[model samples]
Target: MYAAFRDTVSMREVFDSCSGVTDVVSWNTVLGGYVKCGDIGNARMMFEEMPQRNGVSWSAMVGAYAGSGELDVAREMLDEMPAVGRNIVTWNSMITGFARHGLLPLARKMFDEMPVRNLVSWNTMIRGYAVNGEMDGARKLFDVMPEKDVISWTCMISGYAQAGRYTETLELFREMQSESSARPNEVTMVSVLSACAHLTALEEGRWAHTYIDKHKMVLDNDFNLGAALVDMYAKCGKTDMAVKIFHSLDQKNVSAWNALITGLAVNGDVQDCIDVFEQMKRSGEKPNDVTFVGVLTACAHSGLVDEGRRCFQSMSSSNCGVQPEAKHYGCMVDMLGRAGLLEEAEELIRSMPMAPDVMILGALLGACRMHKRFDVAERVQSEIIGLNTRQAGCHVLISDVYAAAGKWGEALDARRVLQKCTIRKLPGSSSSMR
Candidate 1:
């Protein structure tokens, strides 16, 4: 945009670079850019500063905050909207934001209270339920829709895909294909392909790939369908096919790298995950938290304690400018514990500026369980159970730890606590959450 403006005769024309693109195009781009940059603060400032706010501007801000995991901010913004009438897009934004944060009840409530709705609104709610693993709810809603469109069908299929309901997902895809009125677009194909990968249905994935190729989807295509195909192949365990598809792409983005890195990690190719991480760094593509998760998971699975720590320490570089959050800390504890450095793990947890949350302590406690350290296990049991008695597997482990030490009374007490409590484990459960 800047280059085009520079080449033009009218030097008076300003670019978004000049902070003059305050129209929907400019505001949307800037707001969306803030989201993509993970600077929700700046995004919110830009939003508040906009002189005229339209549905697009409002929707952009809502989506921006939601995308950056600021659902509360989104809800507050939604509440401030004019109540004379609600626009479907703005309502959908709130619904989607709630869904993104796993507040399915809130999303459903919004859906129920809406005066009017469109296909996107319905799709947003359905996808929300689907992503939250409430497939029954998704199906229930799906069964009652008075009308169905490609988006509605795609949302249903996506829910199944996310929930690992491949058979149902594929069946729905077949149904969609048979229906002449609904044509599956690239987004629909992405979901279907994702389902195939989840089920490891390589044969079925091949059929989908063939269809995409037959239709010349690679030429002037939707956003990175080829890369999605590569990810689908990698996940389906068709390594050669995935490589071929990946090599065929002339351009690749960080998302493409993420898919491959995470797929390799899931497949237990830890060395490959590390190699890909290095390759991505060499390619000038900075690693995000998702990238760190994949690499850290690989390290945990492969017992690369020192390597994991080294990689984690390197994250302090100003180039990436990424902070090591609770997830990163938890991964480190897991790695240290896996390598039998129980004392070191314990020390790291204790030294953290943010009080060690359940995740870090849980990792350490799990290691204690593996190593039969009754003392550490006993302390960890108290902390973890205090955080959330309803946490699955922890109560059992702590009870077993007591039982191992011949403390039958304590074991029984642990069992009773689990049986009696309906305690809710706090959400996010991170040191920073405090």
Candidate 2:
């Protein structure tokens, strides 16, 4: 019954229908079912009505509250639990809950207070620190851990990758490989392949791919791994290889299609990007915001203004199943701006629900410079200034626009602003020096 509907109401009727067979264990069974489904209201009511409670009962309630992000309530329950009932599993559940919610400080405090430390306890705390970008603390704990598992290694590797420390990510993977007991799993390989992609280390990527093939690692249901492989190959200027792997994928989820579409866009295969998008739509795959970002980017790069406009409009038309995000708007602005459609671009900016970001303004300013439109140039410059953006490139672009329009005084004023910002540019070496 719990397996099918998780129907607590029916389960209660069955329990009540039984002939004087109700006990703490039976009560706990019902409570556990409620806890499992995250029905906090029912669980709370059951807890209050129970004639007697034990460690499991108390622990179930604590776990449920913690899982629901009510960490303070979970802590209160732990405090109320009888001394005999508070065991390692109960403590671990609380810590796991706090960690899962990114409440690192609370999790760490609990970790310090727990009488017994298990592998799960250590892993949970380390993962908490890693997830919250406290890699230093994670590393400190990771170094002192008595026993290490694949999860410990993977957590650190994933943390480093997420922080853009790609070199460290691969280096850690190498260390994981040298250890006899631990080997890279599907999760580990994803981070490692991502690092390879960032560095464009094709040789290393190939080696990783070979490792997967040699191990006969089944990637049938693991589209993330497959997508990572496609992304890595495409980023390394090997779109042909990416296409082959994409075709070989048995199950192409939205993410898989997104990877191929984005990869094609990055590789300058604009027509292929459009073709893949059309194919994805025809196959009943829903295009996400990221998918359209790639499609709009293709149109932008290929100067397909009409196509870009059509794609942008479809985002909110109930058919696309996506809402235009800031990045999608950025792509459209860049597209229209590049095609000398400044009025259309400005109108689009005004229509944005959210204020235009630096990228959108920059695209418009660039178009202003290209077309030598001082009127629009001054308006965009004012907006950029209103933003108080400290970006040196913005000032330089504004200066260039002013100078191109023979506004020497304004150009000098813009250069002064750039100087006031104190942004340093590296000196370029002469060809003779090289």
Candidate 3:
């Protein structure tokens, strides 16, 4: 009972109070409790005090050492174990430890040297590769597995999705559906939906939603899946479906709220996006950086300068405490520039704590072209050139700004610079002397 609760102090008290000798099971249980609690010192002492140790005791100690990142000590313990007593569980522990610590080569070496293998062993290696962004290595091992499970499929699919290979993610999911007998779980659906969202594959995403319904995969229980579905629909220009799913969730987390809010912004339902953000705050979900991005995006879309300014200012330690990141500032600059508040936008850029990126500068330049503010455009051009950017679009915009203001020489100069930026000599070629 003491070991089950993992209350080592109480267990020790009961152990001392025992009038009779404790069995090996009792000792192993206490040892496991200490390991579970991460009290390695006490666990080691308990191991030494054990009159006789079993395979469980040794395996527990090895796992504890490996888990705590004491790989050398774990290896020593494993080697000390009698060959007959060593088990696949012990080998897996070592591999898992090495993989967790980013020691992939060592993990692969251990996996290859193992006298026997199991599903867990293969999964561990595959997961290690996937987690490290080595999807090619993971796929190689996955293709040859004697058997595949949901975990194996999820690991590969999610890996591709995370690595920004959305096309491959969907392709693999299709293969999983047709070739594998294993059913897709909530995790698999989440990745599938995420890829669908990125690719705007509304039909495919709808199928995933239908599959979820057919399987009775409760969205209320998994907010991540709920959020993914919302995102997929929103990106596909189906704000109505996204709204329905958002409202269907009995419990909405920050992620789910973010998806709905951002979706509304993308779909040009500016007012609805702002309303949902207000609703989100009233529901006591502290607005995060992403929430503000959606809000600011909505404001920018509809030229809500005052509202955008208010929302931008609220992203402070005193309010939502989300410091305005570069993107947030860029959105504000874009909004102000579009509204013909060129000076204010330039002021905001100057006030930024970090160096303004090319995108932020480009927004100001584009606005200068729109408003015929050649003076401001010239200054922005200097800043862009100062940054040594290779973006031809910014340079073209500057040339257009000059042309709009009837400064032909300056316009030609800008075009020449753009031409120079586009030209590059081949590695083995040069201009002929004559």
Evaluated at residue 252, the lDDT of candidate 3 is 93
lDDT of 3 at 9: 84
Which candidate ranks first by lDDT, i.e. highest?
3
Candidate 3: tens digits of C-alpha lDDT, residues 103-140: 99999999999999999999999998988888999999
* TM-score, one value per model: 0.65, 0.93, 0.86
RMSD of model 2, in Å?
A: 3.3
Local distance difference test, per candidate? Answer: 0.75, 0.86, 0.90
**Which regions of candidate 1 fall more than 4 Å away from where they truly are?**
1-149, 159-167, 219-224, 352-359, 404-413, 419-434
Please give the lDDT score for candidate 3.
0.90
Leading candidate by TM-score: 2
Clashes of each: 0, 0, 0
Cα distance off (Å), candidate 1, residue 316: 3.5
Measured on C-alpha atoms, candidate 1 has an lDDT of: 0.75
Worst 10 residues of 3 by lDDT: 425-434
Give per-residue lDDT, candidate 1, residue 175. Answer: 86
Cα misplacement distance, residue 146 of candidate 1 (Å): 7.5
Candidate 1 lDDT over 1-434, as tens digits, reads 42333322232234333755556566555555555556677767767777667766676677676666678877787787766534787788788878888988888998999989888888888889887889899989988887888878988887787777878999999988886388777777877788887778888889898888776666124566766787788888776677677667777677777777877877788898899889989988888887888888889889988789878888878756678888888888888887888888887877676777766876776777677777887777767866764564566667766777788898898778766885333465521211
Which of the predicted structures, 1 or 2, would earn the higher TM-score when compared with the native? 2
